[model samples]
Each structure stands twice: as C-alpha cells, then as structure tokens.
Target: MAYVLTGCVAVIGSNSLGLGPIAPEVARSLGSTVPTVMMAAAAFGLGTAASALFLARHIDRIGSRRMLQIALALLAAALVLSALSPMVSVLIVSQLIAGIASGIALPAIYSSAAAIAPSGRESRTIGVVLTGWTLSMVVGVALSAVLADFVHWRAVFAAIAILALAAIAMLSISKYREVLATESAPLPLEALQIKGIKPLLIACGAFMAAFYGIYGYLGDYLHHGLGQPVSANGLAALVYGLGFGAATLLDNVVDRLGARRVMPAAFLATGVVYVSMALFGGSFTMLLIAVFLWGLANHFGLNVLIMRLSAIDPARRGTIMGLNSAVTYLAGFVGTAAFAPLHTEFGFAVSTFVAAGLMVVAVLAAASRPTEAIVHTVQSERQLQ
Candidate 1:
C-alpha cells in the first residue's frame, strides 16, 4: 500500500517536475521556443489548481482508494495522449487533462499517508512518502533527460504512462481505505479559516513561486546558454534528488523539535541557497552543488508544511491538502508566467534574484509564532494522533 501511494506520487511528480529537464528537447521536437513549450506546463498547473479547488473535497466523500483508482485511469489516458500529441496546442490540452487527474490524485496520496500512519510515527510515515519527490526527481526528471536524449522525448511520457498503469494494478487488488474526512470536514475554501492555515498556504505559494520561477528555465540555461548536452541536466537532477532523499533522515528531528520551530531556519537556508544559485549559476559545477543544497533545504520546507497543515485539521485534511496542492500548482503557473520575460531576456540569473526574494516571504510567513495556547492545542492534537 505504501508502495502504491509512493508510486502515485512519483507519477504525478514526473508530469510536473520532469518537464523541466526535458523542456529543451520537447521544444525542438515541437518546433517551438522553450518558453512557448512551457505554456503547456503552465496550462497543466492551471488545470490542476482549478480541479483541486473544485473537486478535492469529493475525496472526503469517496474513499481515497476509489478516488485514486479513477485518477490513475485518467492520468494514464492523459500521458498516452501527451505521448501522441502532434503539436504544442495538443500537448497543452493533454497535459491539462493529466493535471486534472493529479489534482485529485495528490491529495488522495497525502490523506492516505496520514490515515494509515501509526500514532507518533506520522511524521516518519509522511517523510517516507515524501521521498516520492526524490523518486520523481531521480527517476522521472533525471531519467527523462537521458531518455529524451537517447530516445525520443515522447518515449519519456510513454515510460511514465507505464508506471502509472502499474500503480493502478497494484491498487486494484489491495483492500485499501484511507479516508481523512469526518462529518466536520471543511469545504475547500473553508479550510482556509482554520488557525494558521492562511499563512501556511501563503508560505506554500511563495516557496513554489521561487522554485518554479528559477526551475522553469534551469534546463534552458544549462543546455542553450551553457552549450551543455541534455544529459548534463539529468546529472543535475540526479544530484538534487539524492540530496532530497537524504533529507528524509532528518524528519524525525523535525518531529522532535516541532515544525514551527524548524520552518523559519529551513526557509532561511533555502533563501541562502537561492542567493548562491543566482550568483553562481553560470558555473555548471557550482550550480549542481547549489541544487544539492537546494534539495536538502526544500525537503524540510515541504515536510513541515505538511506536518503543520495536517495537524491543524485532521477532520478536513482532504480539503486542507487539496488547498495546498491548489496553491502549489497555481503558484507554479504564476511563477512560470511571471518569470518568463526575465528569463527570456536576461537569462536565469535575473530570475533568481526574484526567486531569492520570494524565499524571504516564505521565511517571514514561517516565522510567525503561534500563541502558547495555540501551540499547546497543536501539540495536544499531535499527541492524540
């Protein structure tokens, strides 16, 4: 069951993060510019954000298992469509379809992790699940560049489609049920009213904006700007993913220290990394080293965000996490669109300046301390889990 959920996250992450490493190749294949090809990626982000906002609450009504099955089916179909797309417009539509599936699929994954988790072990369980990000970065993003270089860019999508299908089969025979909603489960927007949720969502948005703003052009900068082969980008992702996976070892520490206490430092580290990236991006070796640190810091940021949000409203976890994904993917769209001009004209460094600033916002948001009463309440709820 853990593997199935992990697989689902990997598949979704591939469709989202994997696009970055292969964007240059896809651009060439479709006779388009990198930014133009990225419009399809933006469309995917937009589609998922909208679907999660509107339909994520439904996961509370239906079992997570059932919701996942439906979503996997749609994702497989969308990947197949993407592999066969003849042009950017067609690719955009296919990706949007995949995004719609992901909107439901991701929240289901998170909700399931929390449901089956043993008390006091929830953070470790979630950290283990969050390793799916590393899997996507390594297997999805890293390998996609290699596959796109050696084979066709379309083959990458075809391969991810196969993984999605396998996950569906794994899910079908399992007697699975992980429903995180109760009678009081909030609607999508209502999840916002929960104490501290608004700030968390804002932090989520700013963090994602920073990542997407720089990452959307990372491959282009490495490939076109530096005259590196596509495989070089794969190597970068592999290094980053390793660092990301390694950070899971520290989740228990966060569990011990408390998420709020750790988040400010994590975001600050991320800001420093972004600053390093902006200053040293022209050096591929330095960039790879920087991204390794980038992954390390980001893993903590993502982990605690989930830890805080999930603890805040267990009854409405589906809705809360749905809003998390919605904000995250929407930020991806906004980041990509907002950074396009700077990336196109001035190269990657200029965009990193803004990305670094956004991290400051995340740092500020995370630093807002909870009242002692509220902290006591949060701690008590966590103990109950």
Candidate 2:
C-alpha cells in the first residue's frame, strides 16, 4: 500500500511541477511567452534525467526504502518552496527539485513492485499499480487547468504539494514498511555493459525527441493552432488518457507478446498515426483518432520497456529502473527542446513528420532483438522451484 501510494505520487510529480493548465497563467505571471514558460517543463525533464543517472546506483547500494523516505521529504520541501516562490526562476528551481524527488521515487517504487510480485500476476499487478500514476496525469492536466482558471495557479500548485506531503506521511507508517530493502545490493554497474541496452537507449532517445515534441506542444496546438478552448484540450487529453488506459487493459497481451514483438507493433501504429496527421493536419476527427492511438501505443511501449528493465536484474531493481527513468527524461528533454524550435519554423505537420521518422527507426531497432520469450523467463523461474 505504501509502495502503491508512493508510486502514484512519483508518477504525478512531473505534471504537477509542470505547466499543465497553468501554462498561460504562469506565463502571464512571469511576463513571459508560452514557449519561454515551457522551459520549466524542459527543466523538469532535464532534472529527472540527470538525477536518475546520478542517484540510481546509490539507491541500490543504500536500499530502496530508505531512499523512498528521503525522496519523499525532498519532494515535500520542493513543493512547499514552489508554492511560495516569488520569482519564476525560483519556481523553476523548485520544480527541478520536485523532478529529482520524482526521479528518485520511480525506480524505488518499481523495484518494490518487482520484489513483491505475487504468484503468477506480476505483469498485471504492476500494470494496475502504474495505472494510478497515468490516471493522475490525465486528471491532473484537466483538473489543474480548471483550478488554475477558477483559483490562482499558485493555489493549484499548493494543493498538489499538500497531497504529496500527505502521501509522504502515509508512507511513513509502519504498515508500509515492506518497501524498504533488506540488504544493500552491490550495484551491477555491468548492466551498463549490456551491449544492446546502450543502443536501445539511443533509439529510445530519438523516439522521445519526437514523442515529447508533439506531446509537449499538443495543448498549444489545440488551443493556438486549432483555436480550441481549454475544455476541448481536456477532452482531447481524455482521449489520449483512454489510450493509455487501454494499454493497461491489454497488459496481459503485452506480457505474452514480450518486448521484441510488442515494441515494433506499437511503434508502427504510432508512425501510422503521425504520418496520417502530417499529410492531413486539418481533419480534427482524424487528428483525434491519431492522438488517441498514438497515446495508447506510445504508453504501451513505455510500460513494456519499463517491465523489461525490471526483469533485467531482479535484486538491483532500483538501480536499473532508476537508470531507465533517467534515460526516459533525457529523451523528454531532447523531444521538448527539439520540437519548440521546429514548431516555430516548420509548423505542426512537419514537426509531426519528424516524430514519425523517429518511430520508424525505433521499430527497426526493436525488431533487431531476438524473440526467445524473455517474459516467460519469470515463469520458468517459478517452475524451477
């Protein structure tokens, strides 16, 4: 239960620290443009990426539980600071700290889930737990926007901060103690030595550049480009969220397909949507379908990759997952930053084309892997007893 709560908290932290519904309001407050206000989002991503790389192995060495406690405290502090921030720069820095807390918590929570995998339900259970976070993001964006419109954006952030702090207090309870690691595992720095993972990281990096590029600008696209209201943006976001929810529904299928088979199909589906949108940008219905499918496939691929990392080294889960999150964020930074300039010069259609190209490459890379039932290995491990 503690792990479950913390996992959700970790997942939602980035969105909470980010622009979300408050993008316009925050921009107005800072006397900045939308693109400039967006750098806060980029900063959060960079912080997550950097911290995940730097602190992942340390969590493995110290123990996930202790790290969770510390992370929660940091998160609480960062939120408070952000709530009271007097300047945009201070707010951005606070957001970076929040990103670090998020980065630290993700691997530890994932490691805990992998550690506590019950009987034959590891994948499903993991999916269910992770869904909480995705749900938070979808809800957070829309709800936070509403709150920002009604109340001040600062109040919206203050509410999120309080929730995070509440979660921290809950996590400190004795009943949730199992989240702690028993013995410090020696960091398997050699996991980096896994020849294919580095290349896989590069491929993912490119994929993310495209992913974030489109997604980072999606709200703006709907609002500025399409002249839609925030309510419309929320509805669109709902469609995208449904896509993520759909993937969780298919978690068992994903587990059966394994990474090699699942990843390529997802990327292909994503490319199809992006290409369709690029060729015909004015069709709202078509774009909606594209966004929904893209969200579904992209998130499915993301969860699949996450599960794969959790499988790599059972005992050193925090380190591995942390490293993966770091990579994930690094990709986000590249995607967001890359898209901003592209959106400025070429427009959304061409920018989406760029994203589609990256997905094509990701599909090819995913296909190159040997498909020998990596998912079945856990079943084999169970049978060996």
Counting only residues 3 or more apart in sequence or on different chains, how many pairs clash (N, Cα, C under 3 Å) in candidate 2? 1
User: Model 1: per-residue lDDT, tens digit, 78-179?
Assistant: 999999999988888999999999998998888888777677776677888889988987877767878999999999899989999999899998777564
| Candidate 2 segments whose C-alpha is farther than 4 A from its true place | 2-18, 27-37, 174-191, 223-231, 370-385
- CA deviation > 4 Å runs, candidate 1: 19-37, 86-88, 142-155, 179-186, 223-230, 279-282, 344-350, 369-385
The residue-by-residue lDDT of candidate 2 on 105-183, one tens digit each, is 7777777666666645566667666766556667666667778788877877777777666666666663633444466
lDDT of each: 0.84, 0.71
Looking at model 1, which ten-residue stretch has the lowest summed lDDT? 177-186
TM-score of each: 0.86, 0.84
**After aligning candidate 1 to the native by TM-score, how far in Å is the CA of 270 from where it should be?**
0.5
Q: What local lDDT score does residue 381 receive in model 1, on the 0 to 100 scale?
A: 100
TM-score for candidate 1, residues paired by index = 0.86
Write out the backbone clash pairs for model 2.
209-335
